[model samples]
Target chain A: MIQFHNVTYTYNFNTDTCKDAIKNINLKILPGEFLAIIGQTGSGKSTLVEHMNGLKKPTVGEVFVSGQDIWQKKFDITKVRFKVGLVFQYPEHQMFEQDVFSEIAFGLRNNGIAETKIESLIFEALDFVGLPHDILNSSPFDFSGGQKRKIAIASTIAMQPDVIILDEPTAGLDPYSSELLLKKFKDYNKNKGKTVILVSHSMEEVVRFADRVIVMHNGEIKMEGEPRKIFTKVEELNEMGLDVPQILKVFLELRKLGFPARADIYTVEEAKQEFFRLKNLTKGGKSFVK
Target chain B: MLNNMMVGQFFAADSIIHKLDPRIKLLLTFVYTLLMFFIESMFIFTFNILAIIMVYKLARVPLKILIKSIKRMLPILLISAGINIFLIQGETVFKFLGINITKQGLCMVSTMIVRIICLISGMLLLLYTTSPAELVAAIEKILKPLKIFKVSPEEIAIMFSIALHFVPVLLLEAERIMNAQRARGAKFDSKHLKEKLKAYITIVIPLLISTSNRANDLAIAMESRCYHGGENRTRFKILHYSAYDLYALLISLLYVLLLLIFNKLDFFKIVM
Candidate 1:
């Protein structure tokens, strides 16, 4: 598990325009868990995640990643980075190689891996992202937006990091492509038992895919629990300027109309199941009441 | 990472200096730089220094900022001062370690140092009070009359405007590229020089490519948006000189007159 101890980060410290980005945040992230971090813009979600792999260090406290202090004097931070892969927003901008083959090979080459294994790793990553082999020798900049994003992710995956952090991976992507990417993430977590932390604004994606959810407000953790437990508190989430999934909102609205319904239904499948149960109850002249 | 650059950095305020017209500020800076050579006596330069101090106070620029500017230029100041101290022989005033300190050299050096300081302060008054946009506008206005000589002052003004606007954007872009490379384990902060150099090569290659791409994109964007050359283009902001500029002009004229009067005086010369 990765742990945080009284972490606080302030920008422009000791200046007139000093601001507290994150304050006294302490939490533990278990391995192999699909964790979703939801927060408003400027709520310190990015700052907190940047500290996971030593991209940033807390001004007042410490972060221990997998039982080791990330800021140890002798620690090779590059090794930590290899273990915790971070894909920033607009990952396509990270693509700088002349061709897709070199792009995916970039990470492995930097880590001192053998040249013989790089070809196989590149092919495996390409397969994982579902890109055709013909595109390997082509310029990454020539592809469509969704294709470029996949190539960027493939480069990150070639390193085989135990933990992968994706920040707003579905941003600017269509729903179909977004679902495919989410399914890949789910498979990675299930098949490899590796940690997957997703930072996104989509409540639907967070609820549909995340095993656990953490709600943040003004740089502090307002709530954290299993997605089912977290989805039950619709009122509190609304107060934080956040939303539950549309299915959950529909279920809540049905209850408000005087029909008994579950507030924790977060997916379309769950909504369909609830509707089927309601139909069976009404067919026998049974009354629906909260 | 490069965001703290201070070239032409303006201090935002509502003081009289800040309120003066950019053209008037530019004109006054030129006058003060030339006036530095007119004073013939140490006492007059001392009086002039006091006047500058009063003007600086009127501008309300923090002394801390002024100190930082001087500190940034300290090496230039010290080297010039040192060169004068060792060379230029005259009647010796003091002997230290069998080396002579000349009277004329000391007088000339102090005068040089004061003049340099005054010139820099006068230049900084404009930069500290006037924003970069205003400075470029002032330049355009001053050069407008040169159009009779077949000059295109507006084009130069546009160039300067574009340059100033992109400096911050380019710095941020470079930082972003560096961060992207860092995440890929490029090791920019490695202790080994060769490794660090190799890491920088990775960043620089991408930076160059991105810069060219941005340039092409900007050109296309401008063209597609119907950006014509600076011919018959009406300005959005028309600079107007108000009573504040009139008062600044009068004060600058009075200072120039004082320097002209000091040109003939040799009392309190203090050659040493």
Candidate 2:
């Protein structure tokens, strides 16, 4: 679990160019939950998540991980990083080892895991990311973009951290690959009961998978609730330069046209079910379909 | 740690120096360096320092920022001055722990320090006043005559601009890679040299790959846009010499004339 108390981060602090990246942020992430943070670019989303793992020190307040203030004088930040893993955006760019196996083992080796145990963890992570065993000896650069991304994720997961924070892992990936990657994280959250925090711009992805959503704008948390509750405020989201899921937008439009369609439907399956129920009602005689 | 570098960073200000043509500024900087080397008397050095201070004030650059920029060069200044203080052979004025401190050495050290400071400040003044884009355009215009030897000025200018543009960006990428490695428990603050070097390898290899990958992508994007080696190309903003540039050139000439005159009048020389 992580908690932020009155945290504020200012970039270029003590300089003329200093500007607040995040201001007075108070947040708590419970154990074993999938939380998504959605925001427009430069909305302090990245700055907020960087503090969770002690990668960035807050300018004003404290970040407590598991009831320990991370910035305490005696506390070791490296140990905190091992407990809270952060997979940055385009993590594949961080790959450096000669081969996939060593690349995946990089974090484990850094954590001082025994040589005998690193192999098993590497293979387990590769299996979780759906990478083939034969490619272990191949160089990571020899793989395609999607496979490289998988290798990067496998590298992070091999460390077996308690909390996993991903900053826009799905960016620049094909839709199918994006969905597959998110599904893996979902399984990691559900089966392993690990805390998963995803920073993303995709509303559909967030609505489909996240249990709770936090919307950020102008360095402040503007809204926080379940995806269904958050997506209902379409106008406010638009004003913040964000969008709701496409299916929810369609349903909202349908409701605006005097149909009985629910404006809260987000996923395609829910939208389809709502349309079918409306069609049945229309077939009965009291219909607003026209 | 890497953010302290002031290389190639432009400070924006609304002043005559900022508005002067980049070509003129570049030429004036060259002339200033040449004139600095020609000084052999303390009077000329003092006059040069005063001129730099006056120009710095006219440019409206913050005093603190200028001092901060100079602070980075302090170690080099100290090392060179220390070497000159004891090494120069001249009249011995004193002795410290078996080392002879010479009067001539002290004079040489002060003169060298002033010259170096004046040179650095003059170059920084040029960078602080001109934007990178304007500098590139000015270079292209100045190098236009090199086309006769099968050289392409536009290509050279584009390369210079791209290199300048990516310095800060690549620095940011390097920082990002460093943070990612740190998240994996790589300890960069380790005191052992070998461990520190190993930690840096994680950052270096990834940064190199990403740099090449970015270069490849940029090349493809440029090619797709039908870039054909800058042949028959037109510029969006053409470089032009204005009255400000002329005035700047005149002032620099005047400074050089004063320096030449001071070189002959050694009446206020420091006795060596």
Candidate 3:
């Protein structure tokens, strides 16, 4: 539901140390799609996602959300933000309310949602993030880091924006919590049919959940396609300081050894299926095994 | 908006002022500011302004950047000058909107503005030429004598440097928190004062929380690294005074002498 046309953003503009954070970005996000943006550090992933919610206006081009130009004169930017929720990196540090209930209700209240409906929405968000209802009265700061991250996510999801953009949502979390959190976002996108744009560094997570992947390097979009297609260019990705999933690396090694295994196998499940299929082919007696 | 803050910011350049000893620069700035208050004549003020302009040229700092730095103080300057124009009572030279504008008021306002400008420019010149580390070292050197009173100049200097280093970090954090609040639909640009205050509350609470959290983490990290309050620690770069420092001190002494001479000369003095 968000589109960027020739968007270029420069930080510290008009200063001697001015830098182009993102340059000449032309992108489009479809409704209900799980889009993952992968890049090295300072590769403009955060800047690109920040533009989706109009948090950072592009210095050069136009960003359109749901067919409306967000930066147009007289356009209400708050409205755009309400429709496109952004969960910043280290979002738990942005928590301010005294308790979990008020913390989750903060966005709903700011968006002028009905007072009576805020409680229900907060409960719904807590449910979505797997937080319990009993801890609503407790202070958010008293929770563990993962719980705090869930509370932060609940705070954003309470607003129920049509498009949710998360910048490194799973950063600093354990692997299990990261996977669980990504699953929640997947459920949110699948069940609600809402657009989800994730800025991530994990190739495995992107290959697992992302319907489309966009690789960024040096303030420009380097590649864009399905995960399988994107992972096929392992050398190019490595040159840009990015890596493919481990399963794909194994399959690539098999291909190099004269085995006919598929090189595009990303997830472990796909690798298992490919292994069985190869075993079945080898069972014909004329084996191609190295 | 916070990026416009030029206080404590250094502009790196290869110039005589930038190469001079930081201790000398600090002392000269303090002495120049003191001398600025002793001036009683327009001629001395003009002379000080010319001297400041010459120093600016010697420092090789761009004129536009200097003007931009001064522009941030325009509101305070105008407000103070406006108050002086209307409130100071003397011979009424003119009237505007039923308020008398006195000649003494005009003279006092001019002197006040000149003095403030000279003081600010002198401080800014010192900051623009000297890096923060050097400034802290110079401060420690100046306060070294206080060691006799059970004070640790090294610890104070480390604290000062840390405080200076965190200013930009906190500003960046504040900006991030502000954007996060805005993304939550908080309207910071509202015209109502109450709404604006409410918006800022969201930013302030988060900023304070993060600041303390950061401080705690930094303390732990320092402890892990065996940091022991700067006792018996060696420095990487030691401060040294050269011939240029002596030259700078002599020039400032001459400038102070000129100010004293002009204070004695009543021919160019303006009666307030």
Candidate 4:
């Protein structure tokens, strides 16, 4: 588990006008959990998670990852970074290689992995992201936006990090690209049992992929619970300048309109099943199968 | 990061000074700077100060901003003043322990200090009022004749604009890299100059690499956007001169005349 105990961080502390980015707080994230952190910009969500990878340290408190003090003097941060791979927003911007193959291999090479095994690992990472070998030799700059995002994620995955943290991975992507990315993330979580921490503001995306939801506002955790539980309170989330998944909003509307529908439905499929069951009951045993 | 800092140096304003034709302003700045060197009298200094006040007023620039400009020059100003007070040979003021302060030396020192202040103030006024992009365009226009020598004005313009734009970006990046290094146990102030230099080198290497990448990315992005050169390019905001500009030129000329009168009045002696 990754834990934050009474952590507080103020950026630009040496200057007179330092800003408190994260307040004192305590939280624990269990292993293998697909956790989604939702917040507006400068809400301390990014600051809190950076501590997990030793990218940032708390000004007052301590951060422990996998029961080890990350801020310890002898702790090899490169190793810590390997354990928790962070893919920042617009990950494609970080790509500097001439081709996709070399781009993915860059991280593994940095980690002192064997040269012979690098090709196999690169291919595996590419396959995991569903990119073909033909494109591997091509310039990353020549690829489409969605393809670039895939290649970026593939590069991070090649390092075989135990925990993958992505910040707005699907931002600016088209509907199809977003769906593809979400599916890949879900696949990685299910098949590899990797701990996934996704930082996003997309309610639909979070509700679809996250098992646990973390809500942040003004440098503090506003709420934290299961997706169903957190998303059910449409009013509270709305008041906090956040929105719920469209399906959840629809369910809430249905409930308001006197329909006996569940308010916690996050996906379209779940809402569809509830609607179908309700229709059948109202039809008095008449099966209206479409 | 240094580039980013320079970018922020070109403050933006929408006053009369900002609205002046950049080409005219550039030429006027040079003329004004040259005239300051010619003026070796207290009356000329008074005239210069009046001109500064008038420009500041017309620009609607705050006194606080003017004070800020002065504050930035304080260290150099004080240094020059100190050197004149102690190091230079002059008529003795008090004969402090075999030291002499000559009357001629004191006069020379004060005039030099005034000239420096005037030069600094003039440059600050120019930069404070003009946007960096407009200054780039102005410089490009002035250097347009150099195109006959196979010099690409467009390329130079792009370089100027890019440099201006990236100053803040680089400064922010430096701060980020420095913070990252600090978090990794890199001490910038460990009472050892070599260790401090090493810390700075670590910061500089990454900064240089990232800047290179940014430059490459910017080139690609610009190319993709069909930025061939300034040859066929038309400005989105074309500058024009108004009555205010004519009046400003007239005032500047009058100020120079007053400076000449001051030299004749013997308020201060001409150095050359």
Candidate 5:
């Protein structure tokens, strides 16, 4: 479990230009849950999420990963990092390695895993991300942006962290690559039972991957609930500079158009099922407007 | 951080120095430094100055950059000159207020100043033309034979690469911290030593905080890739030398040989 108890981070703490990035907000994530954190730019999403793995210690509060306080001197911070794998936005900017195999092996080497284990782990990670083993020796820089994205995620997966946090993982990818990455992440989460947390700007991604949606506004959580529940309040999300999923928006507009449709759909699959049911109901020729 | 740091720093131009192997460059600087320490006459110093000019031109570094580098070392230059001019035991020309001005002392100070400037500019010219990435590439290649000794070149390359990558980030953080302190009414421009000291201290503390945070994030990013230090790793883009590189190396050798020959025979010391 990961917990943030009244965590607040003030950048430039000693200087006059010090500004609060995150206010006193308490948050908790249970084991094996996929949570999506959504907020406007500069809403403290990055700062708040970085604290999950002891990347940033709170200035005023505490962050606990598992049962131990991350800041305690007795606990190894590096060990904390091994459990929480974070893939930064534009992670490709840090890719200085020659090929995919070495790139994926970077984390394992840091953990001091045996060379024999490292090779197998690298291949397994590449396979898990749908990249071929033959591409191991290929330069990461030569790959397409989407392929590089997969390699980056595979790099993190090779660490075998229990909790994986991705920051704007699909910021600039085609819809096809984006869907591919999301599907791979879902498969990883389900098959490995690893906790996945994503910070994204896309409402559709949040609706798709997130089991719980966390809406942050002005360094505080405006709302937190299941996607279906939180997204139903379209007005609240709009006020926070966020949007509900397109399907949910369409149903809300349908209600405004005097249709008896409920606006609870958060996915295309769910929307398709609901649309078929509505079509069948109307097919009975019962259009008596009382 | 200071964004302007990237204006021309660490860019590899097609200059002669950029083509020289890093090991050779390192050797050149070491030789230059040693020569500067042993050489005393103005004529030898003049030879050093000419060598400096040759490098400055060959590296394609602007004269203004050499001047800027010298400017930062002005305080040390002045202090060394002041001590030499006042304390050295020599033939005194005049004495004013118990201060003696000697003929040899003045000459010594001049030689010292010129030697120091020449030494610094020669090294700075090397850095100005060689990109950090290219330098690391060269270093990794040079260290490749270490694999016979069971050493890892990839680990060394990664260390240098990470250090180079953070240079810009560190400078940017410093700029932000300075601006933040300025916004808080910290008088960085104050002439008072104490106030300036306080302002600098304020700037450094926050910059340190940001650096550590960046370090943490960078560590995690590095670890995820299974970066075991220097073990059985291959490179992506291997560096190679062309005919131009060989030509540049030949010219540098000829220049150094000319300097060495003149110094060995003592043909130019009379000009001092």
Candidate 6:
């Protein structure tokens, strides 16, 4: 489990221009849980997630990972980082190797894995991300935008980290590619049972993929719960400068129109099922409005 | 760790220095630097120090930031002083470890050190008060006259501004790549220089590739907008020299004249 104790981060400390980024954050992230950290821009969601992998340290509090303070002396913070793979926003900028194969292999090499097993690991990660083997020999910079995103992701996945943290992974991709990537993340989370922390702005993606939701406003966590429970409080979230899923909004409007519909449907699939059930109920020619 | 760097960073504030026109500020900076060459005495240097302090007071930049900026130049300051001690051969006033330390050498090193401190402090004051956007605007305006000689000042301005714009972008990219590599267990701050160099190579290669990609994107965007470089382009904000600018220029001129008067009197030898 990853835990934060009264964590607070102030950028440029002791300076007049210092800003309180995240304040007194206390939370725990259980292993193998798909948690989505949702907040508007500049709400400190990124700062909160960046602490999980030791990219940043809390100024006023301690962060514990698996019963040990990772920032303490002699803890091998780099090893902690290796176990918690962090894919930053626009992670494609991390691509360094000439070919796609080498790009993916870079991580494994850092982990000091044997040369004989590195090739297979690279292929497994590529296959996981649905990247073609034809681009293995070509320069990684030669690919299309979506393909580059996949290759960059594959570079992180080859490490087989215990916890994979992605910051706005699908912000710039096409709809189909984003959906494909989200599905891949779900498979990674379920099949491998690794922790997946997705920092996103899209409530729809959170509703579709995440099992738990964290809502943030300013520099504090406003609420946290299961997706269904969190989306049910539509007014509270909207007040924090965030919107619920479109389906939830649609259902809320439907209820206002006196349809007696559920206002907490979070995903398209859930919306479809609810609408079909409502359609069948109305087809009986009995008064279902009550 | 790179965040501590204060050189070329703007400190947002509303002060007399910040209110001065950037074009006038740039010109005054140039003139002040030229005047530093004629200061031959410690008294003149002392006066320059006072003048710099007064400028800093007007700029309202915190002393902590100035110290941080000068700290980055500490190594250069020491190295210059060390080398000058041996290079300036004259009447040897003292001996240390069988090496002669001349009176002239000591004078020159002190002057050099003071000059560097003043130069850096003055330049950082300008940078601290003037935002990068304003700096670029000032440069484009100052160099506008070069267009008559087929110099293409607008293209030069565009390049300058783009390069300035990329400093922070690339710094953030480097941090991202650094973190990504660190997550992969790449030891960047190894004890051995060779190991550190190798690790840097891993980070720099990607930065280079992304730079090319960014340039291509910028070119495409510019072309789409019909950017044909400096042909009858009208600026949104025209450069205006107000009474404050005139006052600032006259003050700078008076300061330089004081330095000349002090140097001619050989008044600093009393302190020496």
- Best-performing candidate as measured by DockQ: 2
TM-score of chain B of each: 0.83, 0.94, 0.95, 0.86, 0.82, 0.94
Candidate 1 lDDT, A1-290, residue by residue in tens = 67899999888777777888888899999999999999889988988888887888788888898899888888888888888888888888767778999888888989999999999999988888889888988999899989999999999888989899998998999899899998999999999998999999998899878999888899898899987888788789889888888788888888887777877788888889999987887898877664
Query: Scoring model 2 with DockQ, what do you get?
Result: 0.84
Two-way DockQ contest, 5 vs 6, winner: 6
Count backbone clashes in candidate 3. Answer: 0
Candidate 2 per-residue lDDT, tens place, B1-272, comes to: 56877453788989988889999998898988998898888777877778788888999987666778788898999999998899988788999789999998999998898889888888989888899999999888889899999899889999999999999999899899999999888879988999899999999999998888899999999999998666678888888889988888887898798788768676666655
Q: Which portions of model 1 miss their true places by more than 4 Å?
A: A284-290, B32-54, B69-121, B146-159, B191-194, B204-237, B256-272
Best by TM-score: 3
Residue A68, model 5: lDDT of 83
Q: In candidate 6, which residue pairs clash?
A: none
Residue-by-residue lDDT tens digits, candidate 3, A1-290: 88999999999987778999999999999999999999999999988988999989899999999999999999989999999999999999999999999889988988889999999998899898888899999999999999999999999999999999999999999988898889999999999999999999889999899999999999999999999899888899999999999888898888888779987788888989999998898787866656
Ranking by TM-score: 3, 2, 6, 1, 4, 5
Candidate 2's residue-wise lDDT over A138-224, tens digit each? 999998888899899999999999999999999998888898889999999999999999999889889988999999999999999
Alpha-carbon shift of residue B141 in model 1 (angstroms)? 2.7
lDDT of 6 by residue, B152-246 (tens): 77788889889988888888777878877776667797888987887898889888988998999999999999987776888766767788888
Instruction: Report the candidate with higher lDDT, 1 versus 6.
Output: 6
The CAPRI quality class of candidate 5 comes to incorrect
**TM-score of every candidate:** 0.83, 0.94, 0.96, 0.64, 0.55, 0.91
lDDT of 5 by residue, A133-195 (tens): 899888887888778878878888888888988889998988887888888788778888889
Cα error, residue B213 of model 3, in Å, equals 1.6
Interface RMSD score of candidate 6: 1.3
Off by over 4 Å in 2: B84-86, B93-99, B228-231
From the highest DockQ down, the ranking of the candidates is 2, 3, 6, 1, 4, 5
